[model samples]
Target: MPKSLQGLTVLVTRPAHQASRFQQLLAAEGAHAVLFPVVEICPPDDLAALTAQLVDIATYDTALFISANAVDYGLKALATPQILHHLTLGAIGKKTAQALQQHGFTAQWVPTAGFTSEDWLALPQTQQLAGRRILIFRGAGGRELLADTLRQRGATVTQVDVYQRVCPKIAVSQLKQHHEQQQLDIIAVTSSEGILNLVAMLDNPAWIKTLSLLVGSPRMRETARQAGFDGTLIMADNPSDEAMLQALIQWAQE
Candidate 1:
């Protein structure tokens, strides 16, 4: 394949653990990957609350994993194997589904494209969730679109935030060094939290304006704009690494 992303230095702002695979994907497209993890995934402050939810996991008719982090943190919180196996499993996207599958649970329902809560709600399985009990596992303080929409559709939605996402503190200095070098070309901002953290981490205003933003959704583009980042907003076909890579290739061709 032609290397369209050749010589481009892209900054990846996902959680550090999750950044490697995406960095590798970018490398395959001939882009230089800059490691700048904005969000750090950690256990929620209230362990007992998560524990209580896991103990009662089987009571919900459907278990929805909001993200791959949710699958990692939520499944790890489970005190028993039986209850988890009995409940119907669903994942938000292909990555989340793969994460669940790796943990020995197959997601019976997964959205084929458009990896968002609205996309999941559009599926036939989710459309029939009326009168059903749905359990959502995600990080603390994210969007309530999924649970709220499910309730409006007549499903009883129970949310259990199993993990917490906070900005990692150490990347600021490294980002300053990169800014001085004018090394960052393309920036991949996956979520609102990541965008916020990235904006906070970069000290130089010129650096923020110089780099083009590769956002997962239009929502993220708005978040980037609000943070005073007056850069080009490039939306991928989907939030997947493959889609972002294709976007990068297209951007290079343009």
Candidate 2:
């Protein structure tokens, strides 16, 4: 509301559906928010297989969601959402937990401090698992850290892919046009895959490497570095839209 980001141009690389709130946040501060969606969220290829798994949903001791998309799509795959009430529901972040709440399910465990798998695994409740049946609902090709660690703790972790992320086809000239006009200030990406897609979308990304880069997590920042982005890397405390906006405002003030 203070116009803290006045005159700034921010390149938002989140999926189109998730970019609107962040765009509004930037616009509220008088910053020019550019929409350049790098990732597209879609249903998994085998919806039948995903739906079939829900038949035995009551067999699992616990159900964990990796993201809000997982919560939405995963629940939709179920024939009877009420069947999930018996399981110990867990969410990786507050947002994911909130998503479950919207559908009348309460998450018994959600990390108060961090959103990563390591943070969730650090909980004493997760570490003491032995012969626990854990079901993970997530997008395709996500990190295996959570499931792998739970398996090590003697839990039978079954991961189900509810959604898949693919890079959308967009013209490189769109970003190039902005860069050429010297209108680009900062580029914000939330995921490792998004950052990679951003780079791949550009025909020549050398100029992007010089602009300020804001990322949601350390993993995303590291991915940017790996992709040859040597810009000023700004890490958000979390991937939430609010946290990302706060990080952007803080960087602008600095």
Candidate 3:
């Protein structure tokens, strides 16, 4: 009888700490929230490369962070205050920028509206990457559009993979068992990688067919469509918890 999500079950695929707030918001809307973390955040094994890059941090004209995780893990690797003050920081979105600000770094540039590489590239600051040295801190394996475009503009780009995101190997069995039992109703995927990992774990077409997917962005929606997900693919305008919760509530209501 409620306008909010009542009987629907929604899955949250964000990291453990990040998932809780979204879960609470969904619960407030009366949807059953389930967490199925597709990726676990871990520090990179080799900091030597990152350490060397930081030595010349002051030389770089700009620094970029692709995700909030990058701000979290990348800031932790810097052992001193001096390195933090050297370059102008840029973030892909408000959330990532906020994380940087929380860690005492102020971002001079952020995407105007959309939280994607294409949006960031359109910023006036990104126009003249020529002759500028740029450092990008992010998780392992992501879009290279920004880096490639910067290089095309004659910027010397250095990428530091500060954190690694890997699907939990142990979750495979647990997810399979849950799927068999039909315990999962809606599965949320924030990244394209998370969707791929979910598909990889559940190779059975029939099982994957039964699950509804909620993606965080249009980029991820494209990924799901490409991966043969013909069912409804809901999109969150951004990756923030509020955006995700709102999308989940709307999906549940439908």
Candidate 4:
């Protein structure tokens, strides 16, 4: 028989627009999907700073995007294709690079091994950033290590938050009802912030004991552990849809 996740209800906590593929994958293996979209992405409230920074885009030696959302929002704000031809582009992960490529911009640098800030810092291109001006488009409040490390390496890094990620206020009631009914099985968290938000939503330890936890990386797995997730924690090798499905398949087999 096909590997079965029968009767297992997996909670996907990614943004709603991004959860469909993962939900379908789980459903194909007999798992019920509980969509508790804990995070929502919105363009930054104030765009003036971003606009001011972009005015000098041609002056920067490199521009970096840390996430696909950053690429999406950043491109949307630019509203024209001319800005891309002015500078070299760097992406922290394959997904981010792919996003840029889809928008017809190529990434000159991408992390080959791990897709974290530390991994980005270790890349050979980062060694000599002296006098180079780099623009980083990202969500609010994240990956400080990359920017800080770049500064220490002698690069002038200007980071602009093109988007914001906040817990979805609308999902509170649904999440509570699902927990009370014991309908949640596995909780899939792609970031450390998501994990913390999930924990905050639970409100009580009893509610947390009912679900398995799936994470997207070793760093996130460690974060889940630190946050007191006693349930099984399975890590997706990468954040791609295929890697996430493979993780689900492995979990079902065990």
Report RMSD (Å) for each prediction in the order shown.
Answer: 1.9, 1.4, 2.1, 2.0
What local lDDT score does residue 229 receive in model 4, on the 0 to 100 scale? Answer: 81
RMSD of 3: 2.1
Candidate 3 residue-wise lDDT, 78-188, digit = tens: 766457677888999888888888888898899868888888889988887768888999888877888999999889998989899887664567666766777777887
Top-TM-score structure, candidate number: 2
Winner of 2 and 3 under TM-score:
2
Pairs that clash in candidate 1: none
lDDT of 2 at 176: 86
> lDDT of all predictions, in order shown?
0.83, 0.90, 0.80, 0.82
Cα TM-score of candidate 3: 0.91
Error of 1 at 89 (Å): 1.3
Better of 2 and 4 by lDDT: 2
Tens digits of lDDT, candidate 1, 56-116: 6667878999999999888788887557687888899888999988888998889887688
Ranking by lDDT: 2, 1, 4, 3
TM-score of each: 0.92, 0.96, 0.91, 0.91
